[model samples]
Target chain A: MTALINLVYLISVSLFIVGLQRLSSPKTASSGNLIAGLGMGLGVLIALFAPMESGDDNYLIIIGALVLGSGIGLVVAVKVLMTKMPEMVSLFNGLGGACALLISIAELLNFHDSGTFGLAPYLTTLLALLIGSIAFTGSLVAYGKLSGNIKDSWKLPMANMINIILLLTLIAASIYQLQALDTMDLVYFIMILSLVYGITFVLNVGGADMPVIISILNALTGVSAALAGIIYDNMIMLMGGILVGSSGAILTILMCQAMNRSLLNVLAGGFGGGVSSAVQVGDQTVKEVNIMDASIILRYSTNVVFVPGYGMAVAQAQKICKELEDMLEELEVNVRYAIHPVAGRMPGHMNVLLAEADVDYSKLLDLEDANKFLNDTDLTIVVGANDVVNPSALDDPGSPIYGMPILEILKGKHVIVLKRGMSSGYSGIENPLFFHEKTSMLFGDAKKSLNSLLDELKTIV
Target chain B: MHLIIEILTDHLTILFALIMAIFLGFELISKVPTVLHTPLMSGSNAISGVVIIGAIILVRSSGSEDYISLFLGILAILLGTINVVGGHAVTNRMLQMFRKK
Candidate 1:
């Protein structure tokens, strides 16, 4: 029976690897997801059907909880919209953490009952408890911030200083607890500290940095789950946990590089708070163009590049934008999309958004590649995007987003920005690009402006 | 002395397993493109692989007299089920959208 179970574990691990590999491309992604799902389903079945000494009504309880939990998860997963995707991801990640936490606690209770407490298992349980609880609370806070249930930023004066002190105390107390070997009180204290740290760690950060926060928290949960696996001596858990942890860490590094920010800077968390109200535009004037006029410029353009951000997703304008792209191609306008690594609400969000519009994957150029074509492009349309293209990230040292690499779309000859108002973007930093001489603002709703642009282009030809 | 030695060796073995897992973990996900990060997040959540297995083993090992572990075990099962079932379903739904036209 144990060997059969291990065989099932091996199959599940291979499926997970294949699923992750196939997820890299558009064509094989769905089948990969199906394969991974099958593996997980088989794993659960083996666990459920394994013949064991059934206690009175134990199987019933297990089945009941399983059904109830899964029912809730499935309903929410299906019902959540694309705009709410980040929050949902964070929500599910938290649940995974809670699972690991509960399992570790269960182990601790059983070990105590059996009078078998070893140093290694005990320390691992404590570690799992600590990481798991933090992941739970941290993910919840991330969900709240993404969904606007919690304040993205609070005026916690010296928050960084306070966080450092709290971290030190947590470490000191953990060491003391480990030395004394008095179990319950110390475990509870560490759990509480972890939960509190999770809250403050996210609270000090504003909403703009949510994707990074969520990714790192997911990695923390992975590490915790791996620890739980260690306690249980479960090979599947250890392997899965490591995969999730490493993937998250690697993605975090890539995203930080894309933003030109350090992982340490991101964790420190005071940068995304609010735009300073005292800033000036330094004598640059704003330009406005009508839909017909904008269409004429785009129609005659030799090369056009589209840069999208979260606002495009919120406006659900990707389809219409794709329609415009098709029309431009009909006009023999060389068009391509420039995607910032951290463009949308989450990493890779813009890709999904554009992919949903049935945009060809080959046409989407990453940041560096897009910049290569930017200098020669005739018209650059900023569609409901602000921060990713904001020249302040490049030019102004005083700006909070300074040194963050951005699409140098100002290199284009003519630029039109479609936005609802003169609001600062997700980072709440003022965009000097909006005031640039080469840029023109077509201020309105993204979908509305996009429809207008497409209509005018079609009629002109 | 025998029991102490056994426990210490067990600890060492688990530690070795952990370091190896971490090393193997970093190697695999480095090549995943930026475009797939969203699906990757949702897909890997389904990878909460151990929760179900661990919960099952915990419950099976719990003597009928241990109600506390039984309760915790049930809770673990519930949470693990939600993560696995929900995570996979959502990931499939997202990946379906990525299919070629």
Candidate 2:
């Protein structure tokens, strides 16, 4: 490598590190991403400039691929809705996995003709191939689930067991190939099994129960890329892969902590998917509140808190929620948003939704801070949210989500819940908080309900 | 045999570096607040596209590549490029929403 190329690589690595550091804070996150992107662009530019064994036609092909890829990326980033961001992320991640998988395949073919292969690169090739195929196929499955193309319940019985068997088969094939003299059959078999295993593995995970990080199969892509980098001795891939691998792991641990679930349970295709063992029967009636009464309560309150959940996402009520917050703030009311760690389908889903509506980040409070303010608040608005604020999570020992930390919206002096009906949450756990005397149900779609409340507030104040 | 030994040491070096990177990665993004979580996830997803480096190395090293290998190399390059460009662009778009005004 030329000195100039080496210096650029070093600069790119620095940019990645610095950008990642900035991403830890919302204030600098935009600039951080730009910096990292600049680094990646520099790397791509150098790759084009560097000499390759291919003829002039190959250069045309490379540039063509880059342009085609960038066009697709640009369209996806610029045009896709924020609500579908997770699905887009998973699809792109799948492509990255495909990159690694193809690299390993290319290298494996190279080895077949060379008649010589080192142990280290050989092992790296196998590892990359295994993990890469899994990441690609698994990410596609995840994208399907997120996009509702595949039903959540579409899973073979004992699919997890089948996955383990396939995994063992892959390992045994690789081991057998090592003992046997040069043969490409085992490697090809391993690749097929890995791709098949990926599908079967994620198939069993019901969408609602899928863990935030592991569900999308992000870390696996990074793992495969890092291994592939080792095989080829590529520093850019090495650094980027390890960074993603660790970052994804960290997020997984954090999401698990927030959900109060064991990492093992998450990896075992998630728990509490179909039926709940802790169903409760209650005869208490739920009080219904109209927009007029709800707005009156809100207008009079000194402090109000908002607890949003998946229902908000489903109804697309984030914009109205922001409007309501602004209206309340204008009425000299102290308004804040209380966010449960697992409030939405994924980690930080609600935050992203609200941010899209240009809600101030500072007004967003995590579960701990929200708990402190809820007790003193005069009214707490629960919008399209259920389990996250369900006192059942805190008090009902027999509830499936009993031990999970919730928003504690029940602690407020008065609570208004906007819901389509008195249905159970994603975990199939019924909430007793709906029937509490302090809580009043606002039965409707979240967006319409919030619009009504916003209109009523304007009229009253 | 000497060349093989050198290669083994290089792999070992990469292995050690990977181990340390994992720890450092954990430490850096440990306490990221809920609001920044999606952006961070998107950022890391873009970083995963670094496999393009491996793709380039494979494509460049092959002296007399056949049609299948070349096709696969092009496919890898395409996918890697998509990942880097789309991932980072989407992340920046999302982050632009949250950067405090």
Which candidate number has the best TM-score?
A: 2
Highest DockQ, which number? 2
Score candidate 2 by lDDT: 0.81
Residues A306-377, candidate 2, lDDT per residue (tens digit)?
A: 888878888999999999998988889999999887777667888999989988988899989999988899
Measured by TM-score, how close is model 2 to the native structure? 0.94
lDDT of 1 by residue, B1-101 (tens): 65457656886766676677667656766777767888887777677534666777777667666888887887878777777777888887777776665
Model 1 regions more than 4 Å off: A25-27, A49-57, A270-283, A396-399, B1-8, B63-65
**Chain A of model 1 scored by TM-score:** 0.91
List per-model TM-scores for chain B.
0.78, 0.84
Give lDDT per model, in order.
0.78, 0.81
TM-score of chain A of each: 0.91, 0.94
- RMSD of candidates 1 onward, in order: 3.1, 2.6
What is the C-alpha local distance difference test score of candidate 1? Answer: 0.78
Tell me the tens digit of each residue's lDDT in model 2 across B1-101: 65468665767767677777788777888878888888888888898898887776566555434677768888899899889899999998888777644
